[model samples]
Target chain A: MTTLISVPLGEHAYRIAIGANIRRQLPALLAEYTPLTPKAPALIVSNPRIWRHYGTEVHEALTQAGWQVTPCLLPAGERYKTLRTVEKIYDAALRQRLERGSTLFALGGGVIGDMTGFAAATWLRGIAVVQMPTSLLAMVDAAIGGKTGVNHPQGKNLIGAFHQPRLVVIDPDVLVTLPPREFRAGMAEVIKYGVIWDAQLFDLLSQLPRLDRMAALPAEQLLQILERSCQAKVDVVSKDEREAGLRAILNYGHTIGHALESMGNYRLLNHGEAVAIGMIAAGELAVTLGYWSAEAAAAQRALILKAKLPTTIPAHFDVEGLLALLQHDKKVQAQKVRFILPTAIGHGEIFDQVPTELIRETLHRLQA
Target chain B: MTTLISVPLGEHAYRIAIGANIRRQLPALLAEYTPLTPKAPALIVSNPRIWRHYGTEVHEALTQAGWQVTPCLLPAGERYKTLRTVEKIYDAALRQRLERGSTLFALGGGVIGDMTGFAAATWLRGIAVVQMPTSLLAMVDAAIGGKTGVNHPQGKNLIGAFHQPRLVVIDPDVLVTLPPREFRAGMAEVIKYGVIWDAQLFDLLSQLPRLDRMAALPAEQLLQILERSCQAKVDVVSKDEREAGLRAILNYGHTIGHALESMGNYRLLNHGEAVAIGMIAAGELAVTLGYWSAEAAAAQRALILKAKLPTTIPAHFDVEGLLALLQHDKKVQAQKVRFILPTAIGHGEIFDQVPTELIRETLHRLQA
Candidate 1:
């Protein structure tokens, strides 16, 4: 039941392996991708919760396959995604004597993946990292792209690098362990893939009997969602690894989503949750600007609602604060926030000159 | 008379502009290399000492050329080169609203150039960094290479990135204002270029009447040293940008140099002074290992002495401490310290299995 999608990024090209029982394939896959060198150990970076579930099996698997493994536990959650977290990983890698030939295995969700990826990026300039994403959000989005970074107090992803992993291993079996809230939050990015590039995925998501829980979806549908969403991201990232251009569409909801996540102190809203709200705002802005049909916007909203995702700004959210944060968004060009506005159900375009007044008015209308 | 050496690194290609009174040409040179876009300000990262001397003139030139510039004053010294110093540059860049097209001008010595380059490499993933190296050390070596990083508590340059600058503007006039000890230190790297890459340059250096002070050298000779040394570095770096193989030769004296620099707490010996001592150690080790003739080693030592540089290990320096630091060096491949030993004045080769006993004996004999 292994499905492989190749992300063709020239020298950095890698494959995304997805399935239910693919966790067992780590040794074979790691060997195939990056062969183990003598005395070079693999450092597995995971949070306590995820490590508690899969650490022993993974350790045994790698050890049996002939790798000296060192496990590093990181505190779970977005709040712990900082330079301090990266420093600890550096300490572990150095302590374990992970050489340039060694690989770092990121074995949790997006937080673990980002932190570990950034550590790999700066450790001895650059080293190999293998992404073993356990969450849907990471498998289809975060771990697929070469983007790796940590948050600054001033903003999210303020410190980072573009270090691609040697391989990405996605295990759907791990998703069953994810909470319903987290599963639904991950759906936000899945839905974004539909709106930005695949209208068929958008339509398929709308017809699901249940979208809130992983248990409710058929295995076939889950595989399709993972493959198509990953394909959409791979299709984009392979063209532009460093976001020189054409990659702005991948950041469809991130400009507003990052502001929301930062304003909430990364506690009030998870990444996917904030992006869900951001997409709604962007959809509304698109409709108001006459670029998207009202029917398309309504259909998008219905799908997001069906997924049990938030579609409105937080009730007590401050418009001015959001706007201030938006100005600091990394997507800002010439001091103007670059918004990826929907032109149609399956397309989005970069609109850089969107007036602040337009944003203000939209935020005012969306606020409860 | 500006001498331009184009470092052809494919997409990252840039030119080194070397001449007297070239500080005035920064505005025009910057325009030629990376044009200043309206509303995107250039953030100048420099120390108080260098900034106090030439900051205003450079500021006026950029401002008069239609760039909105922001100046950030850093504490001057190698000890201040750390992640904390980079945080301030990020703050200032963010404060000034620097964007992707915006450039960060490093307007001091190697320390300033390295810090600014690292800040730019991480800020917004990366931005353009323009190297304006004031000191002789920075102009000839640090500023020419794409290596950017800061000292980690564990080691020097333990964390960093290979970020090439968009342009390098070298103003030799700044060396006139440089202190005598600092001038002597800068000559160490210049001397290294001669020992490792160019015999003609070595002979030219040996013919100098006085090498301790900047005023003692003829202006034509000074310009030749800067240009030839920079050209040698450019030839190496353009071929091997990330030190995969060939560029390791550029680290001729760095194996011991870094250990000396680190053991001294980066205070007792500055980068160039430590390198001067390390070169002497490396030369002696080469002779002991039968890789180089004693005549060549003595010639190397004579040039170092002619430049008024130290030719022996520091008195009371701990041999064990320095040896321990050498093992942790980034150049250590598979637990063996990779040494670049000279076979002739113009050539050096990478030798990996230099016996630790040989190093021990060399240190014991060279000790004051």
Candidate 2:
């Protein structure tokens, strides 16, 4: 069974088709929602690792659907997510003569999705991009939001555009190949949905015995996690496509998470791992500010621990450095860092006036 | 007197304020349409030549309006319209700690407007961009539309996004310093508006005793040209924000114009000069195809000549070379060149099946 979550962004709205092995249904799915000209050129952008596994399947599927398919593979990892990397995609796009009606398929994790979406966004001033997220992190968050961009040298995702994907195909079967560490990184976002928007999802995640690997959960549970997480993203993005207001809540742990990733040079911690630690810090800050109960914060930290995600900041990190990095975050307004703090286990709200001293104390306490 | 033309793109709609020395009124105009946070940072993007002339005036005006102003000056001309130049803008934006609320003011010709707008469109996933066109070409054409991008190594505007400006300020007074060749180049697009959408504008230009220089026309005539040209742009763009349909009509001469520009290596011929020659080719093609009459085509040629613009392709351009370049154009749809051919002086239509033979003959006949 397929769970289709429709993101209601009016004309830019698209559907998230979540199922096991649903990558095979891409042609039919696209035909229904975003029908293209027969044999229109489509570029499949992925890294070697993801491409080695599923590139042939997607390529053949698109070709069989009467679409001309070309492959553009790039180096895998968050480090390669830069404008220079996007230029490589542009070179491939130009070589393929990809037109305005053509589509670019993002066939990897968040990094690939971002670069591909951005290339598609700017190529010919805009083109169709279909998100085929292989990693759990991409499937649940990056692939659905239409927040496509590449990292600047000084910051992560500092340069980008709000170009939504035409369709997002999430196949859980592919997560079997996702490394355990990568799997856990995706769980951080899944846990985020539970804390910020869906308490039921949080409770369901808590009920699971282990979430460190895909094998730990039943097929039904994995589907539920993908569905609920994607739906939560759709709910927020559909309401605030440009992060004007409500969409900022989706950055529950991202403000500090991004700074930590940058501070670590994007190597010390994977995005999910950094986010996990950031969530712990935000939870503690909420409790310290009397916004959220200590019991709720404890439960949140315990859940992260169960997922084998980090709940403490690295001891080498200084509060002042992290605070300085926070000011550079894309969400900063008038020099105030906007943080999404949970008031309860299931609800979070945007706070632009979070006291820096409180954040410093929280970070100091969370040092590993 | 200031002439206002509103581009109605729903929420993205903005107004074009046209007058003499309207640069001084930018602060008040932005306050009426796009109110920013007090003392919000604004990056003024211009080339050294444009900056040396009017940069101080714009900077001081913005500074007095309570904007924290920073100037990012780049090399002038089309060759500098590349992603590398945009990177300079990104670096400057980063240096200023430009937030999502900050605005980028493009204070030069088409090159500056395009690069600045593209930078704003992608900076922090997009911010505000106000187009302060300092050239006649930019005022009547590039500044009015949201088509913003830098050229790819392969083609013009191959890498771009449709990012509308918050406000467009067109100051005719700035044209005093514009070189004669540059002024005539702008007449190409002005004649385009007359041919494609406004016959009245065409007749008005036809009646102008001399269409080559600013001094040749009265102040009222200049304002009329600016107002009518901007209104024609607004009329087409409001209906088609993206070049999905009616908007392509604006590319009347651009199909061949872009190809010719590419053939000249973007150095031999200015955009307006290439476009002037392209309009002649398109007019001849329309006549040959029986979609338009020879008399009407002659009238267009006469008007272009009156503006002292080129009416013939350079003798060195071969038909085969130009044809091959057309395939790489952003407007080519599914291996077919999409040409905007004139049906009459005031009306034009998109033609995707323009015969290569006819274009070959048209080029053959127009060789200088």
Candidate 3:
């Protein structure tokens, strides 16, 4: 099924299609920019793990469609998302003679999306980046919106630019190959949408069958869920694309989730898994802050539990180390910790200048 | 003479205010963001040259006005406009605890203006960069319209972001101590505005008194010329904010100018001087292409020659060496070279696919 998602960015709005067998048609979809130039190169950048799976298909598709394709394989890992890696992308693009009209395709997960996006954003002051998301994490979060950026060693998503992709091609069939744990990690964000803004969707998610054993999600069901989540995001980003106010709601569980990711060395736990546990802590805080009734908090707990994500940080992780990392998070403004707390099912409250005492107290309850 | 030079960016129209003692009043003007919090930290990035002159005054003005201040001194040189230098500003902002709503003041010439603007553009995804230009070269070109970015080793400004400054504060009195040679180089761009966009200004320039004793230019007359030149540039940049079409006209002489700067060790000559010579070559190309009448071309040459700028490359420079450098210029869209050529006085054309044979022929003439 081909589902078109249009992010309403005023005059710059374009369509993103999520479906199967879409990789074979990118050359035709991107034909507009090609004839605009006499020679438009296609530079495909991905990691070794992903390239081994889908690289040849991309090469064959673009080559067969009468396009000059240059493939560059980068080593996969979050640690490789640095200035050095971004430089390598530019080096390869330059070597391959990728001109201004040339299209850059980021053909992997979020790291590739971000690295390529940053490279494209800065190359000649900006270029067109076509996102081909090959992972559930990328399809659900990283692939959408114009927020393309890389993680700084100090914090995740620290050094980046808001360079929107010209196209985002998400093939749900690719999720079939994702490990069970990896797929579950991405579900954390999906659940976040239902908890903070869609009670009906939350109820539907609670009723869905076991996710671990599912092979291919029915096209219509997948499209409906993906479209709704994207619409929720689109509505918020359209209102506040730069994360000033409305967009911060998207960081519902990220305050503690980011810290947990850093404390665990970003390798031990995936982002969504950390956010799942962070949501539990937020639920408890919501009740303590008197914004959420126990029943509403329980409803949120049920979603995470049903999704089978971690309810808390791993037993070995350091709470103090995590706290230190949270201090450096970009979300912390005015030198005081900030939290996006769930007020109730389908609602959120951004609490700025929240005291460290409240945060520690919330974390203390999580220890239980 | 607080002339409000309008940067015509429809909704986000900013102004370049040229007057005396303007720097002292910066605090009172920014009531919008400062009231967000008390003791807002600001990072003041300056080069050794400007810091020696007005650094403490600017720093003290902010701090004494109840705003927190931090100073980072970078070495003064055009070569310092690199990613490495931009990183130093980033690291300093981080170290100084510069936060959201905290502003960055760039107090120097075009290099300082460009890098600081880029750092501000990408800091925390974006921030306010206030341009305080100390040189005449920066005042009319670099300080207006929000194009802040840094240079890549591969090419001049190959890697950068299009960030606009919140306010551009031009204190023309600061030029009292500018060296004679540096001042002459600045006139090249000043004259460029006359040649490429303002016929009336061009007529005014030709009728002006002797430029031989440039140091004797009264402050009032100097301010008037700078104001007109800057207004012309701001009008173009504000309309085509990203150099898409109208803004490319601003590169009227920068094609050969940038290549010459890189090939000349970036020390023997100033930027304005190289552009002066580059503008002459472009004038020759325009005439050869029959786009510019010989009388108009000679008139353009007279203005530059009056400022004592070279009409051809120095005998020591090699044609092939410059050609090798030109290939690295960021403006290349494909195998065809893109040169922003002047069609007539006060008129410019953007040729994205300039015939290479024409460029090589132009190169040979410059060598001759």
**TM of each candidate vs. truth:** 0.96, 0.98, 0.94
Per-residue lDDT, model 3, residue B12, is 57
Q: Against the hidden true structure, what lDDT does model 1 obtain?
A: 0.87
Candidate 1 vs candidate 3: the lDDT winner is 1
Candidate scoring better on DockQ of 2 and 3: 2
Which candidate tops lDDT? 2
What level of docking quality does candidate 2 show?
high
Interface RMSD of each: 1.4, 1.0, 2.0
Off by over 4 Å in 1: A35-38, A355-357, B35-38
**Between 1 and 2, whose DockQ is larger?**
2
Best by DockQ: 2
Residue-level lDDT of model 1, residues A102-158, one tens digit each, is 789999999999999988888888888999988888988989888999887677787
The order of the candidates by TM-score, greatest first, is: 2, 1, 3
DockQ of each: 0.62, 0.87, 0.55
State the lDDT of candidate 2 residue by residue for B259-288, as single tens digits. Answer: 998898888888999999999999998998
lDDT of 1 by residue, B37-71 (tens): 53587788898888889999999898998989999
lDDT against the true structure, per candidate, is 0.87, 0.90, 0.77
Worst ten in a row by lDDT for model 1 chain A? A30-39
